[model samples]
Target: MTSSLFYHVSGDGQPLVWLHGWGVNGSIFLPTVTQLSQYRSYCVDLPGFGDSQPQPGTIDDWAELLIAQLPANAIWLGWSLGGLVATRIAQRWPQKIRGLITIASSPCFMAQTTPPWPGIAATVLQQFTQQLEQDLQRTVERFMALQAMGSNSARDDIRHIKELVLSKPLPNATALAQGLEMLQQTDLRQELPHIALPWLRFWGKLDGLVPRRVSTLLPQTPQSQDIILPGASHAPFISHPEDFLHHLRDWLQTTNKGV
Candidate 1:
């Protein structure tokens, strides 16, 4: 069962929901929404992030909880960990998602036991988990820096991320731990082919977290497409909103035209 999640709704048009990456909340997308003003946007603070209360469960559990509160049908856009949740929704309840967009995300976030996967090293994730117990704030800040590591405007990018994180209530300790566990254990590679929705994946060529190599390995559906922003890092939308929006608007327009 899922608890009521906190969200900010705005604009008026086709329903478009925004899901932020791990460690940050909905506010991080505030700067970019103006560019998407043509659509009715719902920026969500996933279960335990931002002001939402924490709920313990697996990725599917999080998806089920979120699906219950979403519009019957909407364009679902997710980033990083939120992307995993959004993909889960696309898989479990395809009827609810008109389209799926994933930013700086991978079907599998960690290396598999058999086939090699492009993702954050297991040791790096483990360090984050261990550090969280010692200094939650510092650990989160470190994660924020990692997201902007390869961007040309890395300092500004980190500032924006930190500002957004500080703008809301800090994520719950349990939620942080749970999110790390999800990143470390969740592997959706085999499940990717099962998703039938029109999917668009956006990546940062310089992203250290979700490497570009992962995109090559993702399951290719007939409607799947990907774009990588040069000189951008994990948070391409944050670092280069205009460039990100350009491609996004073009894709949406083209997709709409086809319909």
Candidate 2:
């Protein structure tokens, strides 16, 4: 990992790393940091977003880069695309992960027929990829709008997401393209069953990008748990931070007792 991949560490308790979703930076987790202040938290600007410089590679490569920087044996909380990266790290470096939490994330972000996993249509993703090439700013804006589509407080959610994105430097265009490609091509369904760490998956009932139907297909291990927020959308942490944090704290206290 390069020194340019910026991260901020705060609080003073069990270590927790917060990974933001696509098109945004570590600042996306500002609400999370405030609510989950009991734990030592590392909020990272994934390579290419915010102050971090871009590094081109596959999902696995991105995971490796992050793994190099992250503290050992820390709880990882990833949102959207960051979830996929977190899963990759857990799969490859199991000993480094204490627990795994995925918010509004899916194993397979693009739809599949044989397994019937709910996801975005490939063509729609392609359209976003194409649009991104022409107008990076507008494409990101459209994506932010889509994230807030199904929330009960859609207007507020949209405004909140927009404000966060604008708060940081605009994400690198190359990084945006790479993230869309990862969403389209990366599939971890087969690997899900092998992850041995305690796993908690959070879903938004009204999420448009990652359909709630995918939750039904998650691995059923003793260590695995799934929660779907009613009337919440893709960005539940932004839209329903209280409910999100409530469940998160409960899970941390119960599932990861010693952490």
Candidates' lDDT values, in order?
0.88, 0.88
Q: What is the lDDT of residue 135 in candidate 2?
A: 93
Question: Model 1, residue 31: displacement in angstroms?
Answer: 0.7
Given candidate 2, what's the lDDT at residue 245?
88
**Count of clashing pairs, candidate 2:** 0
Q: How accurate is candidate 2 locally (lDDT)?
A: 0.88
Per residue, candidate 2 scores C-alpha lDDT tens digits across 1-259 of 4546888888878889888888888988877797777889999998899888898889987887888888988999999999988988888999988999999998789888885677989999999989998999998888888888979999988888888778889999989989988999999888888999999999999999999888887878888889999989999888889899899899998866754
Q: What is the TM-score of each candidate against the true structure?
A: 0.97, 0.97
Residue 184 in model 2: shift from native, Å? 0.7
Looking at model 1, which ten-residue stretch has the lowest summed lDDT? Answer: 111-120
lDDT of 1 by residue, 133-220 (tens): 9999899889999999989999999998998778888888899998988898887777788887888999999999999988888887
Candidate 1 segments exceeding 4 Å error: none
Error of 2 at 170 (Å): 0.5
Q: Give the TM-score of candidate 1.
A: 0.97
